[model samples]
Target: MKLDIIDLNLSYGSTKVLNGLNMQAKPEITALIGPNATGKSTLLKCVAGILKPTGHILLDGEEILDKRNKELREMISYLPQEIPDLTTLTVMEVVLLGRVNSLSWKVSEEEIDQAYGVLEDLGLDDLAPRPMTELSGGQQQMIYVAQSLVRNPSLLLMDEPTNNLDMQKQLEMFELIKGVTAEKEITTLMVLHDINLASRYADQIVVLRDGKVFCSGPAEEVINEDIIQEVYGVKSTVHFHQDGFPQIVPLCSVRCLPWQKRKDQGLAHQGSVDFGQQN
Candidate 1:
């Protein structure tokens, strides 16, 4: 699937969220990255049909912006940032819920097998019978990802999928997602805060700034020192790994508030400035 966003716009009352946002995502891992409040999550919600935004959103040249919620849910699988606490449900039950649209009064054997297949793929098959509340944050996160995958969607949208995961789990999850995306030819769009991870995992990186696309392309074309400084207001060194992915080494913030202002406000001493305070 190929997703095209044309002249997209969204707002919360008077505050605009997505302003004329445009981007193209194909059947590959495309990372949507930016600083906070850049509309990265908002865009994903819009595509998932959780939020309505004025625009032309086309899936392989078919307009889907006006599609009904049930219709859109069939074509797109969305994993939100916050993991839901489903204490009453087991991992298997949660995973099966992904196919809720197709489920009848009795869940067929085929649906159970399909759900198990996704769990096995994610190495969570053993956790199928366990209560969701008994698992750790990372384990629950993985189960939600499994839930999303069980939908067998053409387009997958994940918001901070690796939020609660450790370093190893994060790597494992990304590798799994990338492998599945390539194998199934699913259009995957992920909202990621870790730019280095995005560069390493994403086939294409889309940088959003203030509700619009700042820059987007292959990591090599978009991940550079100038972009880092401009988009993130941080000074960083960009180095390529042996596998040809860009690794970012952040040094310091270029937009940190002045020392005098911090001192005058009694937030810091005269000689020391708070790097946490940004313009």
Candidate 2:
């Protein structure tokens, strides 16, 4: 699936979140990166049809804004940032719920096989009978990822899919996502905070700043010291690996300098920083 967002706008009461946001996502991983509260998650929700925003969202040249929620849900699988309370549900049950749109009163053998197949692919088949509440946070996060994949969606939207995962697990999860996306030809839009990880895995990176697209391109062109300073207000060194992916080493925030120096440079009030806080 190819997704195109044109002049997208969203607001909450008096504050505007997304303003004339426009981007094109193809059948590959497109990582959205920005500072906190820059409408990264908000854009995901709008695309997922959870929040109605005034804009033109086209899926493969067709408008989806007028589509009903059920229609949209059937076409797109969205994994939200907040994990739901799966207190009594088993892993298999939760995963099967991903097919709720097609499930009958009695689940067919095909649905069961599909659910189990996704769990096995994710290496979570052993946890099928385990209660969700008993699993660790990382385990639960992977299970939700499986739930999103079980639907065989053409378009996948994931918000912070690596949350609560350890270093090794984070790598494993992204590997799975990249592999599945390519094999299935799914258009994936993921919100990620780790710029290096995004650069390494994503085919394209879209940087959001102040509710608009600051820059959009491959990691080689998009991940730079200038973009880091402007979008994140941080001073960083960008190093390129042999494969040409950029790795960011953040030194400090622009506001982390001495007060007098900041004043002299006239950057004291651009962003706040705590002297006692450690990066």
Candidate 3:
């Protein structure tokens, strides 16, 4: 499936968060990368249909704006950033909420099995009986993620899915996401702070900055130092690791060249400033 967003705009009262933003995400993991306050989360909200855009969104040649809530919920599953205060519910019960749109007044065997199955895949089976408050940070995150995956929606949109997780758990979450998306042939889009994770997992990358799209293309095209510097105001070396994905190495401020460091250090040098040894 393909998602085509055309000339989208979003405003927060008086402030404009997104301005004429547009991009397409195909049937693969597409990553949204940008610095803080760049509308990354706002863009995800618009894509997930949580926010009404100024323009239209076409999914597989059909307009999403005309669809009802239940109809929209049938096709897209969204994992929002702010996981609510669900301290009272058990993990299993929370996962069942994702299936609500698919459920009737009575529960079905398939829905129960599907909810349990996804919880297990997300490595939350052991914690199923425990209340959400009893789980650790990573476990809570996994449980929330499981809730999103339970419905098996055709399109999955996530905002900062890997935030506040340990390295091991982050890898585990990535593996589960990769396996499920591949097995179900689902189209997944997510916003991520870690460039390495996005590069390694996402087939496409979109760069957003200051309510506008700096660039939108494959990770290889948009993850370079220039784009990073332009959007993030930082000098970075994007390392292609093992032809799998790109990892970002942010250089130290003292290590940047004269032209690069001048922007931060307020130096007025014209030519290059060699920070290397004078040999």
* Per-candidate count of clashing residue pairs (backbone under 3 Å): 0, 0, 0
The regions of model 1 sitting more than 4 angstroms off are 101-104, 258-279
Given candidate 2, what's the lDDT at residue 209?
90
Error of 2 at 17 (Å): 0.6
Better of 1 and 2 by lDDT: 1
Q: Which of the two candidates, 1 or 2, achieves a greater TM-score against the reference?
A: 1
lDDT of 1 by residue, 1-279 (tens): 999999999999999999999999999999999999999999999999888999889999999978889899889999999766676788989998898853345788998999999999888899999998899989999999999998989999999999889999899899999999999999999999999899999999999999999999999999999999999999999999999999999999987477757767777565756679698
Candidate maximizing lDDT: 1
- Which candidate ranks first by TM-score, i.e. highest? 1
lDDT of 2: 0.92
What is each predicted model's overall lDDT from 0 to 1? 0.92, 0.92, 0.83
Give lDDT for model 1: 0.92
TM-score of each: 0.92, 0.90, 0.86
| TM-score for predicted model 3 compared with the true structure | 0.86
Q: Pick out the ten consecutive residues of candidate 3 with the lowest summed lDDT.
A: 100-109
Query: How many steric overlaps does candidate 2 have?
Result: 0
Where does candidate 3 stray beyond 4 Å?
101-105, 253-279
